[model samples]
Target chain A: MNLHEYQAKELFARYGLPVLPGQVAQTPEEARDIAAALGGTVVIKAQVLVGGRGKAGGVKLAHGPDEAYDRARDILALTIKGLPVRKVLVARAAEIARELYLAILLDRSRKLPLIMLSAAGGVDIEEVARTAPHRIVRRHIPLEGLRPYQARALLKPLFREGSQLTQAADILMKLWRAYSEGDCSLAEINPLAVTPEGKVLALDAKVILDDNADVRHREWEIWRDPDEETLGQRVAREKGLSYVKLDGDIGCVVNGAGLAMATMDLIKHYGGEPANFLDIGGSSNPEKVTAALRIITGESRVRAILFNIFGGITRCDDVANGIVQSLKQSPLPIPLVIRLTGTNEEQARKILSENGLSATTSMDEGVRAVIAKAQEVTA
Target chain B: MSIFIDKSTRLVVQGITGRDGAFHTGQMVAYGTKVVAGVTPGKGGEKLQGVPVFDGVAEAVAATRANASVIYVPAVFAADAIFEAADAGVGLIVCITEGLPVRDTLAAYHHVAALRSRNGTGRPRLVGPNCPGLISPGLSKVGILPGHICKPGPVGVVSRSGTLTYEVVQQLTHAGLGQSTCLGIGGDPVIGTNFIDALEAFAADPRTEGIVLIGEIGGSDEEEAAQFIKRHVRKPVVAFIAGQTAPPGKRMGHAGAIISGGTGTAAEKMAAFEAVGVPVANIPSEIPSLMAEAMGRRRPRSNRAAAGKARRARAASRPRPAARDRARPAAKRARARARKPARRAVARAAGGRGRR
Candidate 1:
């Protein structure tokens, strides 16, 4: 549900936030057209979801349309962090007098929306926190929304009570509107730049929409990146499976999201890297299980497939049936490990045993069995 | 003696005409829950499984005098349902629905909190937006928990997972242990109840001799719970954190479950639990043993009648398809038939998005 910088800025502008005027283009010619219309030094940024774009040479500056076109062409050809640059955003670059950080996000521990501010900007906030902790300031916004006086208080430390403070506070308030009004899970402006002309602009915007809120905001789907998924992910989405492919060798299929992660963690603890995070979810139908198995086996790196199901409402017998049918279709391409427990487990075990397969109720035993099978050939 | 629900509890089911609402309602009633009322907007005059249905929560509350409300509505309307329940003066609310919009939850949460502050008594307790609800063995079952697997016992449980909570509960019951109450606070990023709230309630309950806390790698909730355990809880607590080896920056199913910038890792949570004198189980199965040891050190069992009632009730409620004499495919097909309407309701309510 993360939006590219261009998309984020589009929402920002809708909320009257001080973001520089920008346009998204698919080609270098389009980039040139945008830059020529703006008639100023422009920043051409590659539109990809991955972070560290500047470090990856995905961002460049150009003084004119020709240079803008050249920069966009170069960025478009580059693949940063395995994601191709399909789109580029061209905007009038600003001369900055000061740069600061501002963000509004859900503080999980507090169960509240929190706004964090910092005097330092254009650098990773985590790095700033690690190096100069006092430079950053944090505030929790109550349900009543951020007040004008409170916004003033947030800016007071970064500035002496003046126009700079008022203007920045206004921008922070606007950022809150884009966050709350837009129903974003996370909204940030990394470099809230103060221009040489004393105008504050959101230099870089990032908005992570709350996926659950999509029903409320029907128009948000246009921001989806078409190429951001793997084949397994695409199929899983259509099949109603929760799957995230990872750079590992052990494939995992589990019921319930929490148990899936724990299964992966346990595998890692026993010296195995999980190939993906797959949660068929509760009361999974047989079709989903078949799809999960097919998706995992499709990946050649997978040396073992693990099924860790702790069924409550999800009947273990249903899962066992899925496993049995999958094995019948073709011999398991890799070793199989299962730890099935809870509701209908006795029936599930009977099915597995009749098929010359059995499951361990113990998670530790299941983890060891899979890791051993995985290591048999690799060693 | 349970932390939340008990024999005196009068329950109402929201979304009672919907698929999940109707199915779990039958299970709850069969498990001996006093589900006196149901609410489904336009279908209020109808009777669902002998329970009276109302168009609004206020009418349902007034008619049936149901103090506890369990929600099985679609995620889109879940927040409003909660607000409706709270507005109608339901003392406790358990939302089994998942994928509620976080901002809507924020507003709903604050509304409930504000009401609690204004009243200062019988404040609403929300269980989950994506959870299995909860169970008080032999006394009341207000959620989708397999009641047959639970027995009333000395330990009270709270977790942030659905089946994992049931798994630990199952292991606890399998080894001749029973539970007083178990709470699934859910896996959503913003939820009403956390480990701290449940811990405080368990600490005050007389029947709970020991407690089990199952946490996953997520927000700083575990750490906050650790601090609460250290300060408020004198009862011996056994804890386990899931996702120990989860990689940084990847969300492991739960929206609240991402490890951002090396914070909220299982290692940090385990360290906090250990620092607070709570033993963290190495594996899920080891929890019952740890709880046995922890309970054995401090107190002897006193709630014997409840335990016996739990055992008898569980024996009575186990799903009959596991008898093994029946045809397996027939049983599965029958179960699927029973689940279709509810599943379809859930799918339609889910609107084909968000984490299930």
Candidate 2:
């Protein structure tokens, strides 16, 4: 749910935060047109989700419309971190100034929204925290949210006095509004820049909305980037499964979040790599299991498919029936191993046995079996 | 003797008329939980599975004297349900609902913290917004845990996962290490109960001779729990953490289960536990052996043997699942069939969304 720089700026503008005017263009000609309309030196940034876009040469400065087109074309042709630039954000370049970092995020430990401000900005906050921890100041916002006085106090260390501090505090308050109202897990302005004229502007914006809050904020659907999702991930999501693709040979399908991760860990521990992490979730039926199997088998790199279901509310029999039904439809070319236990496990074992597919109940045994099978396939 | 629930827990099922509510309510009642009443707005005066239904938690609490409440409402209404249960003076609120917005949870959590019960008994102890509720083996089953896999004994288990809890509990039972109580505090980033709360309760319970903590990569709760275990817990505690192989920035199914900003990783949490002298199990199956070894190390040889004998005798004396309860799968399968249309609609609406 990470918003691109341009989308984050759009949200920042909606919340009345001071942001430089920017337009996102999908093509080099569009970038040139936007630069021409702005009539100034423009910065063209690749709109990929990964970090270090500038380090990857996906960000370039252009003096005019013609140069903007050239920069955009080069960025568009290049792929950064395996994700091609689908769009470029063209904005009027800001004058030289000091950079400061400001962010509002959900503090998992405190279970509250935390606002962090630092004199050091426009760089990786983690690097700053690691190298110069004292430069960063943090405050936890209670349920009542960030107070104006608290925002002013947080900015006082960065800005001593006058309109700069006032404007910075105002932007912080507005950023809180965008964060809370937009149901964002993180809203950041990394490089809250001060111009030579002393005016402050957010040079970069990154906002990540809380996905669980999507029920209330349906309008956030427009922010979803389809290009970011692989076909397997999209299908798994549509089927109500949690799936994350990784570069491994053993495809994992498990019942719970913790068990899924443990399975992946056990696979790695047993000298095998996991292709993906997929959780069928609680109360599974045949179709969901079928969907999970289909999604896993769709991965060509997956040499062996593993089903590690420790059924509680999710009946083992249901999952067994799903495996049986799925294999009947389109038999897997890869080695298939399953470990079923818990509720109705006897019946599930019987079901699997009848289909000529034996199962193991021990997780360690299953991991060893799957790793062995996967290696055999690889060999 | 359990940490949170036992035989005296007069339970109330919120959203009793809903699909999940009805199914799990049946399971709870069959497991010998005293389900005194049910709360389903607009269904007052009706009966669900022979339990009286009320329009509100206040009325339900007043009439039936239900001290504990389990919620199965949808995500949007879960926070309000918590507020209602808290306002009505329910002593223990276990919300089984998942996908509650963090904002709503924050509001509910703070609201409950600030309010005292009507009877001046203190604020209600909220267990989860997404969890399989606690179980006291043969004593009482509060939420959706399968009771057949559990056995009452000396071990107190706490986890942030549903099926993972079941896996570890079943392994403990198979290894002749029955549990005194098992609690799933849930896998949400912001839950009412956490590892520290459960660990404190386990530390105080005399019947809980040893503790088994199941944690995953996420918040600093596991690390904090490790510190608590080092300071307050005198009993032997064994730990197992999932997501050791999970990549950073990926939400591993649970809303709280992610490694963000280079913190909350499994390696970090595991190190925190190891630094505190707590033995961390590499896999779930290794938990029982670790617990046994830790407990054996704490007690003398004769006392350990005596405790094992006592645990075995107590497990033998406990009643098994009734024959009628053994016929549960058919009913459960029927309920699963009935829930397909609704589940499909929800999946359709939430297609390709981010992790819940």
Candidate 3:
């Protein structure tokens, strides 16, 4: 899950990280209250789960309470990248002496945590890498160990001279601890701004915790946002299936994540878009199928439903029964294509036919049938 | 001659008393896998499906001499199960459970790597903590991989897609090919046993003739595998990459499938495979046939071209029941109120939202 800047900062503050005092406000009056509490110039930023908010007029500097309210009013009502502003983060603006970038993320290739650092900060890191790849510095922390000194070494170039080097290294080491102990998949302190007074503050923060690690990281649970996706995905999650909403017409219900991806690819290859990625996983219970189909049909963009269950340990008969049960409950008006394989496939097909639902056994035939039905309906 | 599991590999079931554990164990045992023991805390000495259940992995390993382990534990405890099996010196670990915490996986992966490096031996090969697992027909099935569809043959398989593995096997079977072994490496962002890992094993296996590698858009797993193929693998590999036209910047299905900037795309994977001398098949249906042709099968020329043609023609020939199915009621309602102009009820069935 992705936590907004305010949410991440709040968690960082709770963990004793140096963070600027900030409050979230939904209206101008609330912004004024937040500014008055800070009693200084505050930065008003639009709360959206996207980047480049500043470039889009979603972030502004407010001189005082009056300016804070004006900026919040403008930003709170504006939309950035099609996501409406529901909240604005009002933070006390920091005096900058120097800026640096630091982040820790999983390197999939190495199967270990990687720490990324750079002297350049407060801009898109991708741009920096593209334009001047030499500036960005990265270090891999082996699974067997994490050395604080090694992490500090990655930021050695940023130290340059004077007392700033020790302070920067100290901050980097502390950030590494926060990255590891916090169970953060991504912990970034962009523009680790140095004030004229020479104190470091995490002027901006972005932290994404591993959702699966939520059990281990007890304090991070307050950052969970259940309202990110469509209701179907939330329902599917509750039912223990992996479902991600997509923008398309065909409702794809497949068995495995990889297969689900391939099925979606096939849908697109056939010029038919997939509406969602719903994987019932290895279980083929009728209830799970019922839940998956109900979630699919409940979707407004789904014109046709495709059931691609390559039953292995999951009996095909069980998948067929689930589809039958789901159809009985919802009475699918949209065209349905069922492709059942693996253990007891004949029995599965027999059950479907017996229930007056003849599903195609061929994947090509099943995908073709669903795509055609989708086009016919939309046409 | 199979890559990983064969008749000689003794298997142990972890979390044996659980519902999925029991169900899949029954299916695997019926499918001829030599399931010697089960491991569940406090369930030691109990018999499940005529197999002895042990209290721990060490006990199960010591008693049964089980070299292979299939874990069915929940996501919360999956990492511990893998670590337990890894610690117990199990030669092969197949984890069928999904939803392992990323942090746990990171720790487990590092531990496994360390053990592999520290022991002066390779890591006990892990298939998945979130995958469907692997099946070696007429050998030992060490996972919850659906074995009913697989039969013994000479074809080697490695895939990031679980369901696509079946699709490839079905086509291969229809084409008179049986797989020596099939591995579903899974599509989770973090997984055990990547394509390169399986490719190395399949390349060395004597029974395996050629390999069918199916990959999807996301991550550099496919690219790494392709590089390995170019560097070491001599086996003729047939590759099918998924999500060619997936919308830019939007995640198709896998969290790793998001196209950020320019790298890690299906097209890039295809190019990598092609550059590595691995024949890339764009259409899914063409996979088995391409492998068959690579194996020196006499296929009709028209059929091969038509398969590609059919994929294109299929774009426009998709079946639609909505118009005819829903129109029946609409036509009757229109006749009932012929005096008034018919106001079309906005089709809220599917593809209703996001219409321009």
Instruction: Write candidate 1's Cα lDDT for B1-356 as tens digits.
Output: 79889988899999999999999999999999999999999997999999999999999989889999999999989999999999999989999998888888888888898898898884887777788888999999999988988988888999998877877888787665689999899998888998999999999999998899999987898999999988889898999998876777777778778787679899999999999889998778678777776765543255546665786788788755357436567777777757765334323332332112
The DockQ values of the predictions, listed in order, are 0.46, 0.57, 0.35
Docking tier of model 2: it is medium
Model 3 fnat value? 0.65
| Model 3, span B126-200: residue lDDT tens | 887767688888776766666656778778988877677777877776655678999988766788789888999
Residue B12 C-alpha lDDT in model 1: 95
Q: Top model by DockQ, which number? A: 2
TM-score of chain B of 2: 0.83
- Name the weakest run of 10 consecutive residues (lDDT summed) in model 3 chain B: B342-351
For residues A125-209, could you state the per-residue lDDT of candidate 1 as single tens digits?
8898899998888889987888989998878888664888888888888888889989998899989988887787899999899
After superposition, the stretches of candidate 1 with alpha carbons farther than 4 Å from their true spots are A26-30, A77-84, A156-163, A325-332, A353-357, A377-379, B299-356
Comparing 1 and 2 on lDDT, the stronger one? 2
Model 3 B-chain TM: 0.80
Q: Which candidate has the top score in TM-score?
A: 2
- Backbone clash tally for model 1? 4
Query: What is the i-RMS of every prediction?
Result: 1.6, 0.9, 2.5
lDDT tens digits, residue span B174-226, model 2: 76677999999999999998999898899889899999999999889999999
